[model samples]
Target: MFITKSINTFGSYLMLMGKVFARPERMRSFFKQYTKEMSQLGVDSIGIVLLISFFIGAVICIQIKLNIQTPWMPRFVTGYTTREIMLLEFSSSIMCLILAGKVGSNIASELGTMRVTQQIDALEIMGVNSANFLILPKIAALVTMIPFLVTFSIAAGIIGAYATGWFANVINPEDLTYGLQYSFTEWFVWCGIIKSLFFAFIIASVSSFYGYTVEGGSIEVGKSSTNAVVHSSILILFSDLILTQLLTE
Candidate 1:
């Protein structure tokens, strides 16, 4: 019964997502909402993303320094390896997974509140296409902003590596710069961008799905929010694996 019910719910969620992409009744309304969501999801999130990414790069640099003691091995390789890690996954996949927790819950709770309060029903009664109005803007904003966030995270991580390695005497500036440029692959950068887009959709769609289907009041809203974060995180990791396979191999 549980599996059956889960499958049914998944089916319903897929249908709702399809409806979200339908033509908006008012492009102006959607555009306004899109800008608002972009600010909320991207600009507001910059500080936290940078802070975390910096720490990630710093730690990677230290780890590389501590592990390699051979004279034959160049110290600058740490910077290059750090760059590869950040570009390949740390900046994009990991950052989006974190945002899944932050942004996904926010989206779910907002929509769940509207659902329990009947705001969505009222919108339908007023002939407003609620899904297109409320959800499409969010998805659109995320699709655009997340790639930018991924870029920010990459820069932040690189900056972090440079700062920590230079100040701590762990690696010289020239070596770090050389390492950063070592075998840099454009394919890795493209893979990160693709992962960011896929993760953005997963977060927005899953969050809104749980919220839009909520059946009760405040307690259910909270539950929906929690479920949104959990489901989105899981799906992001799963999709990351699939995307990495397809994009890389």
Candidate 2:
């Protein structure tokens, strides 16, 4: 019974998403919302993303260099590994995790507050499509911004890894460049970008669903916000696994 209900709920959610995409008014509202969310997700979050990406890049490079210190180890392995990881996983997956904490939480809180305050209800009463008006914008914004954010993350990761390699003398500047050039794969980068797009959709939809469904008072709103982040994060992880498997296969 529980499984059946869950399936039904998921089906309904998909239907709603379809409808959202079909509506012109919702599309317009989504564009407006997209602009606002793009600023928050891309521009405002840049500092944190850069900091985290840099540290992650440095740590991974250092660790790989230390572990594979054999004389037979290729000089370019460090740079190649770093680039591969950044292009394939770090840029998309790790950045999405950060976004879950930032954009996901914000979406949940905003929608939860509106739901608790009866603003959503008021909009419904006024004959507005609350779901289309509120949720579509968030989904649109995230889908638009995540790809760009992933690009930024990839660039930051590469720079960070390069700096660490230079400082540690693991690879000379020319070798580093060669490794990076040799490691470049358009397919890996494209895969990461696709993953980012899927992640954006999952985060926006899950968070908004929690917020839009909120009931009761302030306490319930808070609960919804927490639930939104928790569930969205879980879903993101699950989706990531599935996407990885599919893409790699």
Candidate 3:
């Protein structure tokens, strides 16, 4: 029964996506919504991304310096490890996981509320492609802006690592800078951006699915929002594993 239900849900999700990708009736209106979504879903998220990544980067640097450093180990290892963690995982996969909670819940709740309020029904009555009108812009906006978010996260994390040197006297600033520059791989940055693109799609689409298909009233909307966050987080983790393997190997 579980397998059957899962398959059925997957099928429904695919069908909805088909509807979502249809050509828009009005390009002007679509572009307007697209811009709005870009601001709301992407721009609004930059602050939280920077804030979290900064602290995480500092913590990672401190932990590596204290716990991992050895008598024989180079001091630069802390900076190197911090850079690798930010570029390879935290900026991409972990950041999306955080966003899954923030942006995913917002999408689910907004759509769920619309569903319960019969706003979608009203669109259907007006001959609008409701799925495309509502979901496409969000998906597009997130996918376009996620690369920027990943870049910001990486920069903020690096700065935070350096902050440890300046504020806490944790390490020599010159050594940390050299470590960050040593053996740096440009592809790692691109890898993070690429992984984030996939994660962005998963978060936007999965959350929108739950929200768009919501049943019942306010209670159901709340449940759908919770489910959206949980499922999106799971999918992001699962995909992160696959993407990491493919990108790295």
- The number of the candidate with the highest TM-score is 3
What is the lDDT for 79 in model 3? 88
Model 1 earns a TM-score of 0.96
Worst 10 residues of 1 by lDDT: 68-77
lDDT of 2 by residue, 98-170 (tens): 7887878788888888988889889889888878877777787788878888888888887887887578775
**1 versus 3: better lDDT goes to:** 3
The digit string of per-residue lDDT tens for model 3 on 1-249 reads: 999999999999999999999998899999999999999999999999999999999999899888898879987888898999999999999999999999999999999999999999999999999999999999999999999999999999999999999999988889899889989999999999999999999999999999999999999999999999999999999999999999999
Per-residue lDDT for 125-221 in model 1, tens only? Answer: 9999898889998899888998889998999898888887668877787888999998888989989999899999999999999988899899999
Residue pairs clashing, model 1: none
- Per-prediction TM-score: 0.96, 0.90, 0.99
Error of 3 at 227 (Å): 0.9
- Model 2 segments beyond 4 Å from truth? 1-5, 15-19, 26-30, 168-171
Q: What's the C-alpha lDDT at position 228 in model 1?
A: 97
* Candidate 3: stretches off by over 4 Å: none
What are the lDDT scores of the predictions, listed in order?
A: 0.89, 0.80, 0.96
TM-score of 2: 0.90
